[model samples]
Target: MRRDVTAIVRRRGAGHDGGRPAPRRHRAHGPAIAHSGVAHLLLAVALARGLAWPAVASQAEAASLAFPAAADARVEEERPEANFGADPGLRTDGGGDPEVRSYLRFDVGGVAGRVSRATLRLYVAAGGETADGPQVYRAGNDWREADVTWNDQPAPSGAIVDDAGAIAEEGWLELDVTRVVDGNGVYTFALFPQSGDGANFHAREADYPPQLVVATGDDRGGGPLVSTPTPPPGSGGDGAAIRASVETTPVRHGDDAADDAAVWIHPTDPGRSAIVGTDKLGGLAIYDLAGEELAYYADSTPNNVDLRYNFPVGGERIALVVTSDTDTDSLRAYQVDPATRELDDVTVRPIDVGIGVAGLCMYVSPVSGRYFAFVGDSSGTVQQWELFDDGTGKVDAAKVRTLSVGSTTEGCVADDGTGDLYVAEEDVGIWRYGAEPEAGGERTEVDAVGGGHLTADVEGLAIYYGGDGGGYLLASSQGSDEFVVYERRGGNAYVTTFSVTAGAVDGVSHTDGLDVTNAALGVAFPNGLFVAQDDRNGDDNQNFKLVPWDDIARAASPPLAVDTGWDPRRVGG
Candidate 1:
């Protein structure tokens, strides 16, 4: 016997119907407590399936579709021709009555494009034989529930589409069907016993019905589904990498803490390149290629510095160094004197952060030819500003957006190639957030505290720009005096960890900030260099050390050898 199913067609951006509450399979045969917002349940369901929650800019833009069960039933193997499609409950497995397999079909359609996530929401009827759930397979789409029989039932692929290992037969169980949905059409699934026991799920006609939710994002949609990685702080590290090294005599500031730095590669003479560093207790320090301080700016307490090349200002293509001024709680922009390798405060106008300006980074949007600065505060709030000239020769910036990841945050970096922002939450881990002003607080913790990939108080984030938007993100694992590296593209995935061991000057530890460049500076650093603030250096005060990028890339086990050729000096070209 066959029964009719109450179909509910839901869609993203489609107006929701104020349908009254229906009894749930888990509850005591009655309406269950209602939640606040309808979108809340939908968002939770979408996230669990790894789908994009629609770009806020285009709230109705997420490629999403939901279809109600067209047919669902349990077919018996003993009576091959018998049809149980009208059963209120779906039974699976084999024991006394023999094998009982369940089949469900959803008329999925409407949306097209790459499916990022798909979920099969089912209501378990409970009291089914205590078994380890059943294995789900993509059954042939040619069968109809009303005519489906064991002997003539549609055949299922040998591939295991998904597995529900003993669902707690109480609440609604969501199964990941992202892999099964390669397109829009008759989506059918067969549930068979993985063991001799059984599990029964409520069929479509029951009070609680089955649903198929599919989430997709148009290729034109921005980066909402991209992934990144990070190591947790307060974790133990193993074997280290010993590579080329150079150390600078400690800074003279009290706590002379070296907070952050950026590499300034000379456009013409690569040998004349310099490294700009931040001194928390003091101001800014410019170092020559030889790791010696060339000039010092004592105007404000600078915490972090990042650079962008070919910034069009007054029709002159000049390199700009953007730094967070802790003393004035504002962003200070300096024009890089590429010829003399000195920094001159362009004043461009101070972008106020309202106090406590700690970490800083700059992002250049590939989609929009605009520049944005990300400022992180001690309170963990991150603010983004778009910089542009206000019809004057002076540079000006406007506050665009803000976000947070809890706890103290410092040392941030932006990938111009991917428009992704990396922020380090000292007590937590590094977080990858969309740099787009419209991109909300949907952040991915590239690393965490319990992962042991990073120690607590993770500080500083720098990305080595490899060509074609590929490279590595290096972080200051201050708690363990080591550095953790992750793939720069995708969700920052972990690569390996290494430390500046005691060799020429001393081992680098308790690092505060760091920078990496793929431009060859000199023979000593023929493979580019890594600059890190060393909290503890030789018996001297805190300072920054220079390590050859090659040593870290080839450090094995946890190594990352990347193309050392993304020259920032050629940016905007």
Candidate 2:
């Protein structure tokens, strides 16, 4: 391309040698030089129009774009090696040409923007004509140019970006493809007419190639600030899992039947605490802080046991321990001496379910100050009973309602503050229900039976309480030997999962049940502690392993919350 220019300059003799064109100069350069010259000429014109050239040039690439397309074809039958990408244009909405949809992909080369305008230009070569414009959609890149058939064409997104209207005479039909191309990557688009009038678009091999043009102006490239879930406050990956803060003395249950354990904190002294572990094949053993067996109540088979710090009983408050006794087929409650750290069988008649007991938990209502027990039996049924003072020294419970899982299930927990209960079906995932005494068995599955999140037969469930009804519900993913935690609020969205790897003490695997607390114990558990039954330790029988709650908290990316002020021991005391 060549151009002529004349400079009108007046000399001392006006019009004598003024405004005359010099001899034309021929220069040998490449297209880059010619493009620069053209750009300079445009810059001069823009300058005259009072425009900023740097701003215009920085947005230069956005001013124009061209792309070469590639796609799979009907090689075995039609002209496969012919190398045609998109066929001219698309005829959509039942336009009768085998329902053709042209897929085009191109790159934006990293120019960020909120598209103010976008257009897809396609050359209409031939075919029946219609007035309604074609629609464009983003598509997957699973198809190829040499092997694709109409039958195997990639399915385009159902979302319609630009619904271009009508192609009358069809030389060049432009459809707004703004929504089709946003940032980068081989972006894909599907073109189809709105109606069955049938139209054709020139292929990539045609002289007039398909082009996607997008433009954006002021206040562009702005969007909502999406973020990775932040770990709970005071939780950070600051340290590794240390040696066991304290491990219980080995149990004699030959088959690793140490099912579950709970921590009972003293009212006045935090360090004066007890761990109550169920020797499933034998009985219940209470251990003091040094892992020394303090007391043992053997004979009855206690599969799962839990304890609440304080229970208002018979004119005086006492800590209580409840267990699911398979032998008696009942939920048995006992009074715990907060000072002596001893357990006494407070023989209130056993809440009999008739089915052998499998798992059990206590729910003390933070709302109405009522205490209820959730008992589960091997017959695949769970019942909630409200326990109240019968004007006597004994505590008796009235059955509220019962729900069944239809499968062998064990291990459950009820959040008193939230009135929510979680039951783990051994071979299934954990299910959630309203823990209200009147709330029926309508359960919502928190985690399902798929993915690495949870393995079949989820065994244990625990909750780490935080202030303002915030906390984490931890599930023992027995199948994967990992514990998964979910936000206590909002559909229990997943937080993270971790395995109790080996340290000074052997790692824990095949965990049956676990418990967590945010209340500060001794210095060993500054952020509280998590006690889990280690089905596999050394060559000895299974035992309870104590892991610092802070270690678990710090290990999480978005760490779990550690409210040093929330003390269960002090809650009702």
Candidate 3:
């Protein structure tokens, strides 16, 4: 269960007793928490009117009786704390008076259970002075609140209080404070409790006698709601779990570049994997898991890179294919070394059918044991390729069939389990073609029941199969900063939609490429990892991000994951 803070406020009503305008309300949700260390000082003006100090304390005890004893409460024997100060240079026009400012810091001990709401009670020891009212502020590091309060009927405008009323005790103000989860700075308030009625009372000077009291509430068992689901098993596991790492290109690189990535798991050794990433410019870089650059392939212009096992020519395994947006549209192949971890040679082959290629999808067919590559081109077409297995075990590219669809095709993928090809169009939703995509063969569009919200710029697409014989179609709603996951029912149709925003990752402003794999690239590799390219991190080139699959699997909400770190190098050094 995930619980969000619904509201944070200091006071009620449009203006203070003095007719000052009220403060604006702040409402936020999700993971982004705001924290400022600044303390807010709230002055309760009504309490200072000719009231004795001892009487103020008694009133506070009475008001506290309204609430029942907290189930998780434990009393701490520590003495109450206090701080006092004034700055002559502070001006009211600046929204704060330095001379009337006060600071109070104290910790509540014997915290027995999770705390949902905390209220502070302060008492004034002297009759001539008043306290600044309380305002709730947040901290960045820890979700703690530094609530400030003051004394007055209908606390001052812009003040953080629930409701302003006459102070029950003389010269003392009772403040009610709330906490901001993300705010990290102190909240300041101006303390100027009045000593007489509204028309006759004059504000006391900073040197006037003043006393402070602080009491905190411990309603851990019953208060506002605070809920968080338990994390999955072995997620933040001990040593030996392959922890995810991140790297960003030097800031000098072009802006918003890193868009997509392709990972090649060594067939013979699952522990090793190689990756090729698109810089969005014409450059292609290869990297290992350790954040080291192994090779750099510059095409002057490249679109995407994918790995596929073409025909095994001579008892060898061939698994490299790159798609380029060059004028002579073609799919390029390279010989990959499983042990040496290198792309030894490169080969470029034009599409056998005249449909120009735009994007590429490569995957090994689990049923056929043969490598299949699908090409999506600007011609609104998808072409299939049967990689020839040269005797030397090298893959020779040959045209299989071409399937045409709506204008401007963007992404294509072959489901290894079903041999069905999933294609995404720029305008329409996702379309599915038969195992063999051919000329004049119209592919069927998946039912748009829950797929209607699929954004206009749905550039990235991936599939996740569930054990219940159902699966998911994860589509990147690039323009919306949301990743929409749809449930795939029978007939390869999507039925429902859910979304998740990846945690703040540089360069991922607009997602372009996405991929997911359950096979372990190494002993520490997560069972499933979702990779996306960040277009907002670097200039001209894009960076990549790795999100844990388990997080996505368990999440009932959106599947957004945070980028753990940043590294720019291509291979592990």
Candidate 4:
């Protein structure tokens, strides 16, 4: 017999403590274990430091207690290698007959205090209920919906948390997941059928997607746990998946060779702009606006690269490109020739960094007219070095400031317009600091993983410049194959998220690093260009994909600004 599990979340102001806290229940189906590691430890430390959750009103506060699915997909045994991430229906079946299973993930990071009750609700599709219902088990939260397949789906962890009996009709199915969902974080669940008869539910891409209802408890009572359906932010149509119009030639080295990229705007000809990319196994590869490789320089593992324009070197203005060399733990500098679109190695001497460099970005100070290179390593240590022209007309650097985070960090970018430095601590989130040397070690968190927008292992970061300090900060949500956009000014409010899907070129996935520009680069990309390292490029070696910023801007709900007037060359001036 199926157990009645309909839980109602009463608002605190209604004079109810949401009833006594529900008794702890767990169906011992698997080994009793919990997720651990450095990331979770950091989360514990963050909470201990009193990093407050979203404010809940003390009185009659109306807040959202229901959260939509963060990610959802199904894997079918018959098509083991194929991915059905775009499908609107999630399927599940067992007992052979082309077995299938559905995965669902929710970001419950907003829930605070003690969890009184949590329910997982799914909208059953018409004629979708089967003779045998499915069992739910806790699963890993790292899988992405866009590319997950039966061959690569995350394995179910722990034992069955709950199960349901045969449903006579199709409407809504609720499963008790309170045992796995304790407080605030990401939770993933997998459902597999008990019999050969399959069942279907609406996926996040379709109408009436899965929802998570959570009720938190305090002494006064529990807050409102409204079951009202509110679409998660940036949950739009195919328009959010922009297509790539151009792709750079695959790198000479294979297997994760291409790491990071930077765009160089032509001072005189916008059409002649170039892209500077780091080939970790090879060296540096320079490509023109059409994705044609102009030159290649062989070096030992160049992890990341960034460029600044109108730099005074050798008594003349030059476009400076800087890369962090992991092999030598040093800095590699290059000068971009506007006419030939080729890079000339301009390193005067070995500017050695004590730690291995994992990420690098160039910053031109608006206050001092000085150029700085921000380099970070795997240990979360970030060092700021001031770049100067040696008497020999080559580049030299002096370390000025050092900063630290809690975990591994790779991608980073410095805004020449606002003098702000943003760093991506892979498993943590994005951190913002003042670019000025004397700015000290104080920093602010722009966003964090499990906050509902970003997944773990956050990668690259790029800023889209707009007029009047209006722009967006874009970060690579590597775990989800999407990018989270936030307003560049003020509080860094979240704008939207978009993905690079297949179009004229293949889509981009597992992107390591990326860059953007607001300067119109000829007819090919009038509103500027976005370049990213694509880890999955069909059959060939890894390469970088290019998309026009205008397409992405117009595809957003309110439409992001397509400002071509923000000159990259004038940012430092």
Candidate 5:
């Protein structure tokens, strides 16, 4: 005899609030009395037709209880026959071999719940007759398992599984499900195997195919959300208001494509600035602040050059010098008319002092108004040159001194306010020379700002005077796709370190040239620009980019917040 878990009440009479008990049926089995209400109903109806009670009861019970709802209840099951094969097209051999593929799918209804445990079991034929075993994978939302096991052993956790062992008749691999919390809906499944040797594995299209199951559970609340923090106030303080711009000057025998540039603001007329840029095969192309080509000189090969503000005999004017790595591989100087923005009618002369003449910096003394140029060679020797006016447009050069640097000297910069010069060696890092720009001078090696942060090819250097009386050192890490900045301490030591992706004007693609403008110049620069050049642009020559100083200052200050609650699954696969 079987009884229903829920009790049933019947209405007694008309307008009655309570119900009377329904009629009960009983039957006699071998030494046992069974209460069979459903059976009795069938028996009474059968008797009216002249049928026997025992026979009618037996037939009704057998017909009604053959299938139960509990027996069909959904339970997680593994389908070993649905294993995946390999692809033949990927194989090098002409013989078309198969591969391994696996998948998992299940529905958790629409309600949300934490997954307690999940597993997949794969059955393989013993004797290694099959090409490969089956691999398992999971596909769903908000479901994660920490330690997945295959054949009762821990499987690799991070990377997706691709290969499996050969399938043997008696050796079946069972994957243990660790945890899963699925929402309601239909899900799909897959199982693939990788080829063991050089054989190609192809998956049969009609294998396990795809299936969906339903999940039955109540919805739980959502998980916690995370976000990045906002930067602090006053992080980017009032930085120096330096600005600058570049114009292509036309010189005889020179291409209009300018490669490098230097700027000199008129001491008398600060509004009028003199710009000198290289014409590659030609001489120097001179321009005014308004981008007007004023004068050109056909003397030196203008590979790369800089302008010294006011030199001896120039008197409030500036001296222009360029590195001629193509011709004599020497540093050459020319005089410029500050008022007219023209090359002074002075004879040009070469300074034969620097070791690496390919890379040179012409720096003017802020206090004494004297001029000196530092030249770098391929052998990593830096030579200093002092300009002596010869009453003509050309000034005679004297060998100041030479300093031994690392191999491949690249970028050099001199701080007018501090009288300290910084040179970046391609492999060795940044080296600092003392106040006097003379040869064999007292030099201190600054701490290599980027140990792991920067890659091998460190290319450019620039300096920004911070509001707090210190300065910021910007270095282009060419290979690493990063531009690193360091805060200057007392001497060669840098106090803090940071980076800016937006300010990465040059190295973003392939940074080559970098320069920082003074406060007076920054104001004239469009939007307080700090300039960098990228030779790796579509063009062979360098193209300049402007970075807002305020953005750089902020990035140098502190870290910003980030959202930690981002889920990659809900967004996509």
Candidate 6:
């Protein structure tokens, strides 16, 4: 069924001459109604195979589904980095005055059976004309709609799926794309023009949004196809989709390599701050604000890392970065070099915590001005250690206390100003405990998996500090691909939730760890920055994504606070 060249079909004008029934169109903003015949066939197959039909589809469309573009945008060469994701129309030109290219992404994970047919349907805008319509090609799924530019746009990776001839009139253009789409997962496509006249089409925001008609292989009865609308936000999360502004270099290793990240705010130059991350399969890496690697060390398998500023080490106050070295069931420490923006190993000796290190976070006590590290394991054992300068300018630690979270756990963070520690129990929820060593093992549940605020396997936990004790607690709801936000003070009431969709960079998914700061980091992040470890990075290895805190604040339903008064340097003061 692989056709090197497929003719593009228009729903209007000459398209009617083919004698095939014209597909029904859904004009309003809602789920698409399916063709009756195709729906019957699909339902028969699903029932015969004992498969669970998705509730999103109606009775008439059970077999076939219509998906609107999950993310779409056009990039113009003239304005390389300018984003046109919100534009009503998308443009594509074949090396004209200013070459323009368009990209579209579709998440087909909901499609149950083998895909027999998939059609990319687009509506030509009224004022545009094309001597030769754009050609469709396969593309990498790593680019985001909100921020994709000509410079960062993914190049077409496969042969033309279809090419339209002359299109003098405006109408619906359908391109058959069954070859590249097989089963459930994210798929990206690129549209490139074949002539100077180029063309314009309605974007996802327009009334005539782009659509994909998917027919499962079980549908033997061929009939006209209709589209299904993209599903709305889940009940557990607010449907806010924020795009990442920057992404760190992909880890050298693949398959669950990048595990966690810690933001290091520069003492004098905030914009020059660095991100220290872990490659669980290999080692640790440091990256600058531009997402370029600054340094990397393959000394140990560090699972999680956290840092605290102003540590009395080596006879001078310095910033310290620490990690749970899972390779040796010990802790590893590094001294931050502001001048080089790199790390220097400073672990005095191998301090074993007696359990396999699964997660780790640093704490600077506001009451005693002491620094501590909480090291935890998959078996739920957590050990607290007090780190101090070992008179010889190296770092050493003394075991202080231990606790049991009662389940498989990882991802933890400590609020230096409030003396509070938050831990995530993978299949369970988040728990809060006093960070001070003497506070003991007593803990309280913050939110649970079925509580509507979180889903199973809660991964990373981060605190966004605001002015006068006003802030928010962010947790990575891994199972749902969303981030749940809660009020920082009071009972930590649920506030809102969001997902990192594609933008200037690719969106984040299955995030393992994340960190945030309210300290303004120059013009790029005047309010602050939020960094998350992205589990999937297209064809490359996993990486970290950076989102401006203000973007999240403004994108929320009631809007989050855009506070930038807190200085990370004064955490324990």
Q: Choose the strongest candidate by TM-score.
A: 6
> What is candidate 2's local distance difference test score?
0.63
lDDT of 4: 0.75
Instruction: List TM-score per model, in order.
Output: 0.57, 0.57, 0.52, 0.60, 0.47, 0.63
How many clashing pairs does model 4 include?
A: 1
* Candidate 5, 358-454: lDDT as tens digits: 6667655556656677777678887777766766545676766777786887677766556778887877677778535543456776645356445
lDDT tens digits by residue: candidate 1, 412-485: 88888888888888877778888889989998889976575888888888888888778889888888878888
Clashes of each: 15, 20, 103, 1, 60, 7
Global lDDT of each candidate: 0.69, 0.63, 0.42, 0.75, 0.41, 0.77
Error of 4 at 110 (Å): 48
- Give one digit per residue, the lDDT tens place, for model 2 in 1-573: 100001111112233212221111111110011123444344334333433232232233333322334331211112223333433233343444234445665545544444333445555544424565556666777767554555566676523444545454324555544433444456667665455554555455433345444444321111110001223555432222323445787776778678899988777777677789999888898886657788888857888888775677788777778888888888778888877787887757777866777888888877777788788766678888777666676667788888988687788999977889999887768889888877787888898768536887688898898888898998887877778888888799877778876543467888888998878775345567788888886888888888767657644654466687766765455
Candidate 3 vs candidate 4, TM-score winner: 4
How do these models rank on lDDT, best leading?
A: 6, 4, 1, 2, 3, 5
lDDT of 3 by residue, 470-560 (tens): 5566776666555655554466543334333322123245677777665544422434456766665433444666554543443432222
Leading candidate by lDDT: 6
**For candidate 6, what is the lDDT?**
0.77
TM-score quality measure for candidate 2: 0.57
For all predictions, the C-alpha RMSD in Å is 22.2, 25.1, 16.6, 17.4, 26.6, 13.6
Error of 1 at 572 (Å): 2.4
Model 6 over residues 1-573: C-alpha lDDT tens digits?
A: 111011222223444323323334422111233445545355334433434233232334445555668888988877898998877777777644567888988777567665545667776665455666777777888887887899999877533455655554345666656545656777788988766777777777654567666666333112434443322454432767766767899998999899899989998988788899999899999998778999999999999999988899866888999998888999999999999998999999988888989899999998999999998898988889999999999999999999899888898989887889999988889999999999988888899988667888899999999878899999999988899999889888998889997744668999998999888775446668899999889889999998878667755645588788888898654
> Scored by Cα lDDT, where does model 3 land?
0.42
Residue 84 lDDT (model 1): 75
